[model samples]
Target: MKAKIFNSEIPFYELLNNDLSGGEIFTVKSEGLKMTEIEMGDYPEYSEFVDTDAFRDILRAEREKLRYGDSKTVRISSFNINKSKGVLEVGFHPSSYSVYKAFNAIKHYPPQIFYRDAGHGLYEEGTSDWLDTGITGNLIRANHCGTGLFIDCAGPGGVRVIVGMRPNREIIDTHRLFRTYSASGSIDLDDLTPFEGVLREAREEINFEADASQIELVSFGYDSQLGYFQFSFYHRSELSFEEIVTGAKGAKDANEYTSLDPVAFSAENIDRTVRDIAEAPWEPSALWTLVVLVARLILSDGAKKGEKSGVTAARIDDFRNKLEKEIKNRNYESNFKIFN
Candidate 1:
């Protein structure tokens, strides 16, 4: 339930690995992404926020009224994409969702006793590093798994991407409802790689278990508002749109979304769909996932990218490029803000 705080779009994302290694490199080895344990108690800043009288009161109040899941989260420590090896690697440590929330409140909320560098200080002081600004700014920077679950199916016209409509915010434990891309959630403590987390999230949210070969890396981005690195992916499914929705009724996290929408895999539809989500209440990671997924559809050869190309392969770079083209072609503005 990491909702957007204000009216502005948080920040634009940076690409880690632009495209796949030669072919669309989906690695068989899980070792590419590694994780080590962390002791959150050892971080003094964490203790400060958790121990704060006002913050504790706020947490207690929120807990009494709304639903909050304080599960163990994964934080990226080091990230690298080994193009030559046809794999992407990430090193991360364990964290809790509650810790992430505390960090968020410290940065965005006002009048908290242990408020570090709160509002203006965060923007003005830090360049690339958040440590230059707030008390637990570094901790805030590396938090949660903003994983997207895209369930793709073949349609009469062509491939159609399934989008989800979440009714009550309680489903995601968020502030507002959304028509976000299929599904998006965090990773568990047991997860080793981002793909694994995506799969798990998909299974829970939509009751769809995907094959390893069918899964493709759509894009890697950072959500500065939530302050965590997000990895978005899509799983090509043999199921029809109806079958997929039917299966979703039996999902473990079926309440996460009330219904799913299938959109034609086209540029105009992508633009329209994003505008709908953006104009309403939606999360940053989900919006970016849809942007990148549509970028794969319009900018690249095909949905799955390994076919020898007279058709140029799509790079992760295409996400921003697509947005830029949308902005200019549509006579919009500076960034990929909420609307055009």
Candidate 2:
């Protein structure tokens, strides 16, 4: 399948490309939506297996912590985007995905992709025969997913930059540069809407608190490699680049990353800027988020404060055109197809 993609090397598969015509937004909370309950015994097939015991033994704080806080997560059974109504309906269930399941899902798929230099050039793909939907693993719920946000700062004198992070060496995707914030669907963060969950995480990650007014939904994608679903967003920050960095020390997740990585953004050379960012050792999911957002920012002409981001079919077509060329220019294009 020539899956819709930003690049073949990247596992991100663009599923629903909703460009809201009027900078509109949608929300998915624990209430007022379609949800179900799925137990572990539902699918017993073990085409791919993960040794929970061995994963626990790894000397990683993040991995070990999840075991204790076994919280419920949102399992995305299905989803739909009604452009006309500006509605995003997410069909999910209460599921639990601890480190055991996350490890099983991203072992080779993300480890090697993000840490290109460290990877041994070998890994596996897909959790089970779950290519049709999301991957549900044996020991964990790999189908349980999260959201990623690409936040940019509007610094002094219109000095705008894309914010990224160099993760701490002990985390899951150790020391790789990634998006500004990540809202994993857990007991407290399980919301499909861009504003609720992502804003919550951003506050914790960088001591920056933002509401729906400054964010926009870029796209929704499924990572075939790990059987993961990712919601992407483009967020604008009013704080200067320097102020944003200093505030991180005050945040609860201050130790989460070693430092921040910001890429200068200008519409004149955005294609080149994104290509350059792609060259860094990056978490594939974050890179995937960057791939879709740069185009939107360029067309939007710098995100405005106190305003919601909107998308239209015509705008999407333009962004897709630029993205296709960006991927093809690198000769990194392969199976995944987006914008089609």
Candidate 3:
């Protein structure tokens, strides 16, 4: 529901004593003689006053601000639309200049406004590194908590990464894609098995067999919606066109969870697609997965370096013992939430 305040309205303050006791001045409609629902809240006394029409002018100007212009329009796919501040916010592609131009033309509300680039053409690439100087929500908190990404092995040339698509019966064949795919109200960092989960999802969804070593950690990101989070991981091993065709043979009638079309993706197309989808994942948790995949590829290719391996399980019992001793010596527990 929308409440409108018109021009040439007089400002009045009111005090209402009721279940909630708080009051403020309201602008009276010049011709309509109306006020906002908020203005009508529990006020016992109303005081009318005449002052400069600054607030009214500002309101009118804001209302008159146009949404789109003649400039190029770029679509930004976002994991969580709720991530943007205000009741609503407009977002654009990361590489899009028009988005910046449009947003800069209009002053934005503060403390909750930000832009995140998922990547170009509906793939995950650069969302995790996005810095949001706004209040943290559940998705953000989950990303901060501990999620990871995974990339399927493409070829020596690398795989085309796409943002995790929304949960559609057509997209992921839940039964066949993963060895064990399950859902929960919450996931424990200790008990979370994204690697196992994703492998299962890939097998069921795409009918691909992926070895554990074939998966690599990319980066960490979060989804503001669903509050579900994950890590991004990627792989570059590829199959021949024949292999792809053969693997997808019986996908249709098997489970009715997904439909496989053995399509080929070019490097340029894949890059753009991954980047575009990064802005929005069909599932917000998939955003983190996309980010991690992109990050690993970039790092392995000598593009960026010095990334942190924030989560881990000890390889050797001796190392584990030593590390635990050191941690215990310093009396250090993880500063972040680690539910398992």
Candidate 4:
């Protein structure tokens, strides 16, 4: 499909050409949103837990303790940008086995370097126009930080299942989360397709299948180094806890030096079990989802005490049908572009 895009500074129109047959040009509505505006203030405080020296020392300790006894090497890739009044920075740290091992404890995506052209070394949070600069894996370089997500299944009325991977070691501890081992490989870590990657990981790790219908794109976020990313989360059909755990245990490959580990997700113990992989180390999507899930649990619990006051089942079904038709109409319009 072909359309025109114009910037305020440029008086003339610019042609926007695309082969996609059916999609709306919603860019106009999203133009004003900046990448660095996300608030990073609410992250867990680990001030007493780690200092730069202590962190580096831990890395050294883990390397010394490797089963195969290999020395760890660090790799780094980075970039800088000029914002309105400040410089925005984004990028990645070293690409080494030790960095991979550190992912479990950090719980954040890999860290990329962020720096401004002319300012103090540390960029204050929330002062820049963009909240996060992280992008999809497609855009990541070896030393660039790309966006990714951590999605664990929660089913059977809010019971949570943790997803984890272990590479080259029996287990590693970060953020105190007890993660199970899983097969590890150097796959593209783009944010846009991390959902698909997760599904692929699920299949390889535990022989579990994720139907497209069962998956949902519930969260969206970015990192300072990566570009736009979608944190897609999914929940499979009902399965016994033993089945889930068994699936995890069986998800090891013959050639790889990793294994899959799945544990039940419980908020009370999650902080103790789930580690951060990123440098900034926060899962806003997962965190917000937990809040929503918890709220839903409360409402559902209260509903059991009394008659459900929302729409009747029949009415809800009718509304769903109506909504489907509307969506189809919109899709038809969007699909029109591919033909043109």
**TM-score against truth, every candidate:** 0.69, 0.62, 0.31, 0.36
Global CA lDDT of candidate 3, please?
0.28
Per-residue C-alpha lDDT of model 1 across residues 46-130, encoded as one tens digit per residue: 4465566876775665445435546777765555555566566555667667655554555656544444454323222342344
> Rank order by lDDT, top first?
1, 2, 4, 3
199 Cα displacement, candidate 1 (Å): 1.6
Where does model 2 exceed 4 Å of error?
Answer: 1-9, 18-68, 99-141, 172-194, 298-340
* Pairs with steric clashes in candidate 2: 3-337, 4-337, 5-337, 5-338, 19-311, 20-311, 23-309, 23-310
Enumerate clash totals for all models, in the order shown. 0, 8, 56, 54
Compare candidates 3 and 4 on lDDT and give the better one: 4
Model 3: how far is 212 from its true place, Å? 1.8
Of the candidates shown, which would achieve the greatest lDDT relative to the real structure? 1
Candidate 4 per-residue lDDT over residues 121-194, each given as its tens digit: 12223312222232212221112122222346543456655444444333422222222222222224332233
Query: Of 1 and 4, which scores higher on lDDT?
Result: 1
Runs off by more than 4 Å, candidate 4? 1-124, 132-192, 222-232, 253-285, 299-340
Candidate with best TM-score: 1
Cα deviation of 109, candidate 4, in Å = 20
Query: Candidate 3 lDDT, tens digit per residue, 179-287?
Result: 1111111222232244554455555444656664566433223332212233334545466434543574564323433322212223224334333432221232332
Ranking 2 against 4 by lDDT, winner: 2
Error of 4 at 232 (Å): 4.3
